[model samples]
Target: MNAIRQRIDTEVIPTPGPNPKNPLQARHLDHRLVHDLIARPEILGRLRALVGNDLVVWASYFFTKEPGGKEIPWHQDANYWPIEPPLNLSVWMAIDEVTTENSCVRIIPGSHRRVVPHVPARDGVAFGQEADPAYVDEDAAVDMVLRPGQFFLFNERLLHQSHRNTSSRRRMGLSARYIPPFVALLDQDAPPLFPDHACVVVSGDDTFGLNRTTNPPPRTA
Candidate 1:
């Protein structure tokens, strides 16, 4: 993984601007780094081991924090993902070193089982907060510090948040969301996949579409 990280960093250039999208930004849909990571046989095998053979690349994004970036408010990934059954996994790969000193994702283990009502995001907030008292347990949250190249896989419903990058160095990470091919989009009105239109291989030669049909119909009771 270290080699992979180094290759991506050396080959890709960072974008400019306060929140310039990272190298694998939404606009660079067919970027080589994106293709290398997603289409890698090892990654695909690992994903299949967990979610079975039929899987879909639901979404992908990059997060980078420079000095004084605002805190990513506490929230669950499921809150933003409009998918039914909530059976999805996220692979958070650290492009730059991550530690509590800078910016690292903090997760509440086993909190994935708790279904809390979604609270709308306040002005300038990246994610919504959990208002339910029962779901807010400060002690349970754990900070995940990863060395460049290391990655963590967690359930989409896991309660998590990231703090501001107080340190001088920048922190960067790439996040990829995956789901079984059977899962369905809960919100038909949700925005199109990042990059608007691009050919992303979710399964075999099938390119990802704005509104693609699922293999096994969404399990709606």
Candidate 2:
């Protein structure tokens, strides 16, 4: 924990930003940890329970929200995803102690049951898009405060968002997306939203041959 914390604190966080995309994507391909976590047997088994026995790691990302970082607007991960019927799920692994004061993730219960409309965000706030706060019972939204090394799984279409890092500590999380091979990504013929990424079959075979991938990017920068 100390080593990775120091790495993130020194190497990843404090990166020149005010960037529009999530901080995680910056190191998405640069780190071997991304692939290692996805290939984890326990993680793969759990993902199989949802999307079926066969699965592919479609995407992975890191979230390192520093103090004073902006709040992520209420939104669904599926809103930007290209998957059909949205069978995707994510495992958010905590790298640091997270809490409500430091902008931990929050989700609306049962919100995964449907897809809601999202509008473009204003003033570069949040994830560049947002769902109406009035759309859900904000009071009922659960705070996913986590201790270091803890993690949680959620559906991609689930209503979730995080707040600003008002507290003094840095908050970090790594998300790995999993889906069955039958599910396809939309808009592949055009410029893709997330580039420099490849999917890998962590467990079973990709019978549909729907994705292309490399044997994990080099770990050393």
Candidate 3:
């Protein structure tokens, strides 16, 4: 991670949040490996049970929260996402050991049952999107602490957040957002996050024909 952080942290005052901005566009980062890892029978097979067989990884990012980093307020992934039906699911793979003090992901139980209203987040937070902090049942928030290589998949609409890392160790999570083929990318009119956002088909086929996913470059010498 030190190498990755050094390689991608090109911005001034980079604090382990979204440096180099979006991970989806990072050349040094290997998106193919991410696709292959989630496509395996053990992972993709289980995802099919929750979503459908026709899957496409439309978005991916690395959420790096350093010790004493910014607060990740309670919010739903679907709030910012433009996908319809909100069927897209997210899988967050832990790249470092996670704990409560380190600000591991926490979720409000049963919060996925409905869409909670979201408003602009306070300044300095990543992405500037958040749900009402008071709306969440803090007592019911379940901490998803994990170690390196462990991951958790959940509904995109699930209410979740992370605290300011009070521990010395930094935390990182790789998130891949998957959705069925029928889900349309409503943000074509909006500015592209990356230079080119291509649909990476992780499982089944893209019969919908609405994707322009560019495959990762072939391995080099």
C-alpha TM-scores of all predictions: 0.75, 0.84, 0.82
Question: Lowest-scoring 10 consecutive residues by lDDT in candidate 2?
Answer: 187-196
As for model 1, its CA RMSD to the true structure in angstroms is 7.2
Alpha-carbon local distance difference test for all models: 0.64, 0.73, 0.70
- List the RMSD of every prediction in angstroms: 7.2, 3.6, 4.4
TM-score of 3: 0.82
Off by over 4 Å in 3: 1-31, 189-192, 216-221
- Backbone clashes per model, in order? 0, 1, 2
Clashes of 2: 1
**Lowest lDDT 10-residue stretch of candidate 3:** 11-20
How does candidate 3 score on lDDT? 0.70
Error of 2 at 142 (Å): 0.7
Error at 24, model 1, angstroms: 5.1
Measured by TM-score, the strongest candidate is: 2
Candidate 2 residue-wise lDDT at 214? 46
Off by over 4 Å in 2: 7-23, 26-30, 122-124, 188-196, 218-221
Whole-model lDDT for model 2 versus the true structure?
0.73
